[model samples]
Target chain A: MQDTVLIVGAGPAGLSAAAQVAGVGYKAVLVEKEDVLGGAPILSGYARLVPSGEWARDAIGRMVKRVEDDGNVTIHKGARVTQLNGEAGRFTAKLSNGKSVKAGAVVLATGFTHFDSVNKPEWGFGTFPDVVTTTQVEQMVTAGKIACPSDGRTPERVAILLCVGSRDRQIGREWCSKVCCTVSANLAMEIKELSPKTQVFIYYMDIRTFGLYEDRFYWKSQEEFRTKFVKARIAEVTAAPDGRLLLKGEDTLVKRPIVIPFDLVVHAVGMDPNMDNPEIAKVFGVGLEKHGFIERGEHYTNTCGTTRPGIYSCGAAYGPETIDDSISQGMAAGARAIADLHGLTRKAS
Target chain B: MAIHEKSLIEPERLLRHDNLVVDGVDVSGHWNTMITPRTITDYDDDFEAVIQRYPGAENVHRCWQCGSCTNSCTMYAQNVQFNPRYWIYAVRTGLKDEIIKDKDIIWQCVSCNKCTSICPKDVRPEGVMKALAHWLEDEGHMPKSPSRIFDEEFTEQIYARGRIEDSLVLLNFLKKTGQPLVPQWLRVFGVRLMQYLPVGLGMRFARNFFIPPRTRSWGRTGEVLRQYVREQKEATHG
Candidate 1:
């Protein structure tokens, strides 16, 4: 009877874990804090995903449907495991929806929160209506119109500044977000395709379209779509008297300061540790790393194993990760949880 | 692709003390040349538009300052100062003062077209170099160069006669540019060619030099072509 896996957060990681556990004929208890599934893809309304160019709703919707249709998976929407009791083999969890479930393993798939652009006031995110984040640009792309939010006019020139919230020593964020470069490149191509007349410029310190993404996003954007990449880190974004946004920065290649005017400016914001990492650590009786992510049990052998036994975690709960990577990690964590539980049952016999 | 410019410390900015002794040690001559630091505060905003007004420079605004053009440049390999990417950046950003500073070196582009072939943005940097040199001469920033005179002679031969007389074109180009009529290499090549000469081909070349070969059907085509070129120049410049 103690073969159930309690999975929290209905994101890509949690959904993948739920499907993996239920597919093997084991009971899975999936509890989500949100009313609907699919996590940030559906919540943030991402237009098209990086690397695949698939619509977020369509790609993540399939994962959500797979877990929901599984008979062995009992999902509690808008609920959380308020209290988790007992040890690895015999664990009892109390949900926020006034239901208690008995499980052998627990998986925390809590994802990240997008870095708010308002924190960098000089970038003029909140001060100007045309200064927006990459997420807002995605929303604008999904709406099929790229216009200035203030005047609702087609922009002649748009500038995307990379590493806004990530890799900024002033903000105390030392880690790279790992996806903004590719995301901004993909977004540049989409913008050029949608509005061919509009010139898009990406200001970057270093273009880290690492590995396979180099040719896919960076090269394709410049070669095919005519997107401009400038080696510059924009220092400030202010408005001109004519209502155009002026970007101040040195053209690092040419070695001179420039103040260029643009109709719109975008901040390629990064991902931060999930805000509930502190509370989730206390409730689950697990330790957190220095950056406030869930710490692993041991550096030698732990891939998904958390500080506490039988309490595994995956995806952005540990650090900033892509959806594809998080999904794979979820499957790995689920397999580890079930394997460890089966070993405990064998020992008891 | 990184250019370490010696022009950063200009000759005019250097103060040379020929016979100075500092602290009982003679730190004179080469060691005494001290460079005065300078700062720039302004740029000519319309300089990019002025360059684009010239032919082959219309796409200067499309440059993103990637160093690919400079990396693949033939002239850049010979002399690092002849960087198409840096000059294009200066043109786009309306840095006229900086461009004038490189006037002595800007015309050194050999027109190998390697930079154009490899440019991801299709900027056609080879054409841009030609246009920029013409702009420098036209704007009175620099005197007319020999390459511009050579281009004029070459184009003039094409318009006057339908076919090119290579020797005549070379003769006219050297005469107008005030260079020596026969350089050492050409003199050596001419002597070698005369020694191993085929009589029939040599006679044809000599005859062509006297009365250059003309395309038989070129009736009013040359006049019409000249008229069209004049109209284009007027339309663009005016």
Candidate 2:
């Protein structure tokens, strides 16, 4: 049996997992669906990493270089796993490119899909030109300008609506998209820095910047950047006759209903289960939780181990997670795979 | 059904038996409290459009009912029934009966613009409140509210002359609204004012009240504005 680990997806989790596997002298096959590596944050154009304020490309590029330089790691970009067969220590993954890799264990690091803001028609995501998702705003940040999509003028006032597709029963997403609060806070600071004249208002049900990120991003967003946090979930977005977007929601803290016009509206969308989650779970012979994320054996002890013995899952494949958690989980999954493969090798000998 | 606001549910719909025995069990007071099942078939559909035709309420149809307007409303703090969000919802949903129930208090909006400033949807709920008040008056749902009478009295002076004499407007508004000209508070305030007033300042105030100051070249400007207002009122009401 080949002492190799097959890593599905080439996101932060998959790349870190592959790096861990290769570091342990085991061959690691990293299969990515996209033509390029990095994943959503890279493809969608994130300007900078949150809290650190480091350029996204540079931070992610360092990881990409580590994986590429390792001779034990093999990267197959623009490829997807078409088929999975066999059990632990004899797993084979057939690639879309007609290539197959037999490995001792597999790690599914497939990440999440950005929640589609269009699903919530009240946000006026697609209907209004100035109303855009957080991902789209990230692209604008990368473009080095925050301008109204309709008029191409610099937005004098921008409203960032947090938890757009998360924590709302109406959309069937009750779980909080963990990273959005920090991301929105970071983005608010970024936008403020980009255009100091522009007023940034964040309408949020809660500011959930858990851990040190709270002090680094959320606190800084308020204390340093002067970002206005309105404690309310926006009810609707409508375009004004003058091309500005109007937001309706209550300031729950002040207990007042408010309507304010903004030059641009940014919907801080959350993460949904990966679109290929069902298909991936089916092929891998794994189980999915109620939310469609791959079910882990036990979070505390067997954090990376999936319902299927040899098949493991990490990062957003399990649930909504931050990049740091994904990377750490990737390492944990890699360590588990290596240990499993070592046991098999010892038995064979 | 998805947008079931508890505030929108009328007290009449709430059924509660103070003392009751049901099927060998006592279901009294809170235990017996139930909401009557209701099927609303009286949607005016065109109510939102009609309200939108008012001067400030052009964007009434855009209410997503986040409850921000009601939450931030100045009038809402004093009276929970003065809910801009619920009224906006009623207008958008064409619940004419629901809106009519709150007609008396709808004109008490204070023009604080607090709702307009904080609304994320830019529904301009303050304007919607004004439009609703106007609609209630235009439709003859009730007599002109005291606030509307005060507005007309204040506005008519401006439309006729270049500006308004504060005393004239105040007295006229009081007369039109059928309030005592010399209220207890106003009498006390006037007495306090006289105690602090200098002879020159008091004489100037008296002269302004008697003569009523007018802006120069006001005749043509006033005529044009009067005609414009007349046309606008006709266009909106007709």
| Fnat of every candidate, listed in order | 0.10, 0.00
lDDT of 1: 0.85
What are the interface RMSDs of all the models? 5.3, 14.8
Candidate whose DockQ is highest? 1
DockQ (C-alpha based) per candidate is: 0.08, 0.01
* Top lDDT prediction, candidate number: 1
Which lDDT tens digits does candidate 2 get at residues B1-238?
2324546777778777899999989987767777775544223546767888998887665554568888888888999989888787677656787788888899899999989998876779989888887788889998886887888988899899979999999898888887897788989999999888798987899999989999986878988999999999999999
Q: What TM-score does each of the candidates earn? A: 0.74, 0.61
Error of 1 at A280 (Å): 0.8
TM-score of chain A of 2: 0.98
lDDT of 2 by residue, A1-349 (tens): 4579999988889999999999999999999999988877787788898756778788888888999999999999999999999999999889999999998899999999999988999889889888888888888888899888887899888889888878889888988999988999899888988898887877887778999997788767765675666667777887677667778777564355566778899989899999898899888889999888888888677769998888888899888998878889999999999998898888889
The models' CA-based lDDT, in order, is 0.85, 0.84
Model 2 interface DockQ: 0.01
